[model samples]
Target: MNPSDAYLAHMDAIVREKVRSIESARAPEQEHYLGQAELWQRVADHVERYRDELSFIVRDLHANPELAFEETRSAEVLATTLERQGFVVKRGAHSLPTALRAEWQSVDFDPRRHRTIAVLAEYDALPGIGHACGHNIIAAAGVGGFLGAAGIGSGKIVFLGTPAEEGHTGKEYMIRAGMLDDIDAAVMVHPFNYDLSAHTWIGRRTLKVVFKGIAAHASMQPYMGRNALDAANLVYQGIGLLRQQMPPSDRIHAVIDEGGHRASIIPERAEMSIYVRSLYVDTLMDLSTRIDDILTGAALMAGVEVERSWDTHPMSLPVRNNTTLADRWAQTQAARGREVLPFGVLPDSQAASTDFGNVSQLVPGIHPTIKVAPPGVALHTKEFADYAATDAAVTAAIDAAVGLGQVIVDTLCDDHLMNKARSEFENAGGPIRATDLR
Candidate 1:
């Protein structure tokens, strides 16, 4: 039988009550050192002036969606736009053909005294679900953000176009190729059902387990042959049992890719693909080890040889949001008449991972969510894809761009805020070696 919708209704009710309670309380004010009302007004005005152009970009991308690592047209549109705005554009940056790196600096820019901020853009679509994740909105917002910050400050701004965020880790690869080497901080926004200051994004690792056994005709010599499908079934059941012992913040899911072809023949080979997730990096690693043990046990019980391979793509780390930067984002959104809720105010039980998490671990960053759809609309769905093409999504994209631009302005001008952001990153274990995750 299918699951009941009662749980969904109950959770929705609980979230509504919690949101009301949180909104009633007054939020603490964030202090500004160098940024003023005029700077924010200027940025907003710049983004507002190009509203039509940004909307066109969003609609164009949504209309012509491209999958990960194949976003040639999408990348070309973004790159051409940035280049027209006087930004030096480089296609195929950091060894990725579809990636981009565009930069603009004020005349007084100095590496010694000023900071460099990156505004990241993602434009990759999912398989058979064009722009369901709203990456088209991301691409447009990032472009608008960079345009707003252009020629405004004495620091530099980079518009980075990252590709393939669906199942592959594009940011991680760019980082390995020196993408974040000179970047002081990074900021971006994602489209979601609600406006959030900091949403929960967990760590993820993919594993592929293969079982090998002798094949024989079941009716002729079934007892003489070992069944690899039996071992695969044992592993699947073992993982289901493991779920009960797992922590509430951890998640595991698996699928059998190969099994016996016919009942009369014992299968020679079988395989299963699994995804393991956890709220923390250490816990994610521990969970992977436990899962490996389960696979080994299943192989031993079924008398089959097992082969385990992990992370055909790069693993995504959990996001460590810098509090100082996130506070500035909240202040910006509030100025636009949107009350951005804090992290814990929303339910985090249903969470996903992002390549941005890896970017945050390497540099202090913020990946807030901007409201584009209703509360009941979830991401990566046909319904959400429909919403992504609407006029409301264009509005959210503009707001997100203004918010990110303001944050970049604040980080470049305010020494106190930058110092605090760096300190917060250090306190949370700064500059993780992504290669050491294994």
Candidate 2:
């Protein structure tokens, strides 16, 4: 059988079994959970039903891996599709070039939207490896989650198309704009090689520093040249020594983009890209600020003027995984027999930073990595890129959509569950966004 045919065959069994479970159970949480489970089975069936059409979406993303905040085509396509699906869509909600929100109203101007939920989709691709992180799948899964709850009886569903997760941390901008102003809770699942939870993400910042010196003939008047390259070298060495005193969790990495034009000349300018990270944003900034001291001191010693230009991505607070939400989410997912992980094995445990951390700081959120590839395979590789369209990944995507949708729906339906989540959120001692961290 062809790959598509084989995939559909396997998918059919998974969905059938899931539907059977749904038919057996009879509670709202169960019926709702099962009903939602059955919904995902339909999504899997829908994928098979629209394989060709959806493949176009994935292929388009693979073909053009745009940077964060610069995803013109991808955002437009996602927005247009959601609009057609009966959502009231807003483009550039946060004034971010690539940020948009698609809303579906059920109660009509809900004063108590009282409960609002967000299903997030990340669309930015790696600089060189297009969709290497499986964002195409992420985008589609976001759509699936939104579709799963397209017309729920109560509350509102917000499908957020966030651009620049790779670097822009677009979600932070959205949060700042009150894009999630009234949102009660948020949940997002990432494509991973395994199913796990209780992940941690470090805070991150971006730096661009430039050095300037008098240009002159290298051999003819070498004595007159200040040697910007040498000065930059000194700065790096200073940065390297500083690392020894920093906490082991801190990461300070920089690269020289230019040295001298040639041995025959003293380069007038040189630039470098710097990335600094730590488990906490406070530590990240403290570490990054130290690097500046080295740069300035080195330039003074070398008699070459130094110019520092830094563009830090949002200061991401450490990920605060909601223990209560996670425990309940796990139990609900486990009831389906898929074996949700035993917490603390997040995919990309080594990943330095993420905007999800920022969101968790603002409001309660889950950034769990769901199983999408073979256990041994690594992410950000060509092999994982191919798996983005795999049968296993697709099923997991549908399951995640249903699972997350149920979590939100469950939270919204229960006054107690909602309050419990909030109580736990405030207790975590995270960012409140107003006065806590300025």
Candidate 3:
């Protein structure tokens, strides 16, 4: 049964009261090398000048939605747009055909001393709900931010087009391909129900299990058959029961891909696909061990041979949002009249996973969210998809561009801020390799 209307209303009222009572704290005071007011004005001017073009990019990507690594035309459009702004654009970058790398640097740029900030973009859509996660807005905002930051011509800026975020870790792939080797920091904005500077995006790993057993006729000599389907069913039920013992941040779900061919005969083979998620890396690893035990126990109980496959693609680590950069992002958004909430203002129950988590482990980064829809409109839905193309989304995209651009400028120009960010990253167990987690 669905939640009662009265219950939902009461919860909404409570949420509203909480939101009203909480005031987002401002970032600590810090002076930048460049004049903040002048740089911010320049960023805002760029957004105003290219507002229409940014909107066009958003609508075009929304109209021509592509899935995962198949975003060929989408990559081309973004690369060409960046090229028009005098950036050196490379399509098919970082070992992915749909990925792009566009860069602009000052005359005196140096990889050894000068900092390089990457503005990440994800443009992949879901299977049936295209742009429902607001990747089109992400692409536009990233392009706009890169362009605005490039106009300053004080430091290096890279606009990275990362694909396959819907169900694949394209950013992780790019990272493995040395995408962040020389990059100092990264920033990106996601379209969400609220402007949040640091939200929980947990780790996720996929598991595939196949069971093989002896088959026999259901009506005749059924006792001789070892049903793989039964094992699969047990695994599902075991996971359901395991949920009660799991941490609130931990999530596990599975689907049986092959249960049986017919109800009459005992199934000889069964297959299941599962997803395990958690907010912490250690917790995710621990949960993975427990899940493996469950799969093994199910196979043993049914006397079926089982084969397991982990991470059909790449696994996504929980995002470690860089507060140093996030605070600057929040301040930038504040200048644009958007109160970017610090972490914990909203409930973490709405948390999801992102490939950028892997990117954060490699370099200091911030993945803030720009509000494009109402509070109740969840992502990955038709309602959110509809909102992703609205005027509100366009405005939010512009604001995100301005905010990201300012953050990049601040990181590049302010040596103190960058050092603090790097120190913070080191203090939080710096430079984790995603593969090592496995």
Candidate 4:
């Protein structure tokens, strides 16, 4: 058989096998659905049927961008779409008004069983370029994956509408509200620098540091003024000095959000956007304390008062890919002659953060990334935004949706696999309260 023919044949066998397994299961197995093969068929069907709609969703979101925490329309659109798929939708799950959650049953196990799996989607766009990061594509892919699962899911599946992933970390709010209470595992896909999903994320924190001081006429009384800009400047300098002593894997990036109002006056207030990253959340906290010291010390030196606010999401532990789940889908993909590739680099590692990390901490989750654009096509750029609408991205979306659907199905139906996944999840310090937020 030709490659395409072989692939189709492989898919046919997988679906048939999965259906047979589901049909053959005993009474105790009623809690699970049939495995990956059948789910793949249904998911691929959903992706194809909704291709134009998903593409339209992605493009429109890309075309009209909004800033973090300001994704009102997009959140509604996502909630509406999932509602149409028959999910019990709840809007504003996280403290953020724009966040939404879609809940439904798949496995008919215990009514309150923590068999729930969550699929996260981000709809907020960047300030200027809009879906430049291809978040719209990410949202659509998530919808496609869950809807496919909904068709054949034996356990619960949640479609979480996360409002702002670019910076505000809306998941942080939802985490505090206990919205993810019933969820046991969470999964999502992201656009990455490469095709492989590395399954690990570096811990990160965002800080908005502000300085306040007395203002005076610049030319007439510059020296008499307690300049807040001076404090901000010194803080940056302090950061530079600290960087020399930081670990090689550590990262610090900053942008001046506010420096001064007018040249005629010594500025009374200034602010900076800052982020610190390391491989572990503990390291991030430790580094944060050190950075805080620097900022305060700088403000004191400049004779200014300082105020700070943080936008931090609940940490997502490093992605713990359910290898069994990956293997099942990988085999299904390989049956079609497609090799499931590992990340060449840290495909899973992001200098950024996701609430999805919180989900990984609880369940056997995977946030695999696929290659739709060229290797150089960085996310959240006009170039990457352009590619998200291309034919290649669409193809990748369909394939990934099918692949993920298959994994979910296999997870539900295979008792050994499901139990293993749950065990690993618990061992990883699983099922913490949705209200557990730092």
Give the candidate number with the greatest lDDT: 1
Measured on C-alpha atoms, candidate 1 has an lDDT of: 0.87
Candidate 2 whole-model C-alpha lDDT, 0 to 1: 0.69
**Candidate models: Cα lDDT each:** 0.87, 0.69, 0.87, 0.66
Candidate 1 C-alpha lDDT tens digits along 1-438 = 222232233346446545643653356654565456778888999999879878988999999999999999999999888777667889999989999999988788899988899999999998888999999999999999999877787899989999999889899999999999999999999999999888889889999889999999899998889889999999889999988877666789999999978888999899999999876666677788889999999999989999999987899888877767887898899888897887667767868899898999989999999999999898999999999999999999999999999999888888888999999899777788658977
lDDT of 2 by residue, 11-74 (tens): 4543453443334332234443335555445434543443443445556776677877778888
Q: CA shift at 144, candidate 3, in angstroms?
A: 0.5
What order do candidates take by lDDT, descending? 1, 3, 2, 4
Residue-level lDDT for 95 in candidate 4: 76
- For model 4, state the Cα shift of residue 3 in Å: 54
TM-scores, one per candidate: 0.93, 0.79, 0.93, 0.77
- Candidate 2 versus truth, CA RMSD in Å, comes to 10.8
Q: List CA RMSD, all candidates.
A: 5.5, 10.8, 6.0, 10.6
Query: Which 10 residues in a row give candidate 4 its minimum summed lDDT?
Result: 23-32
* Steric clash pairs (candidate 1): none
lDDT, candidate 4, at 423: 81
Quick one: RMSD of model 3?
6.0
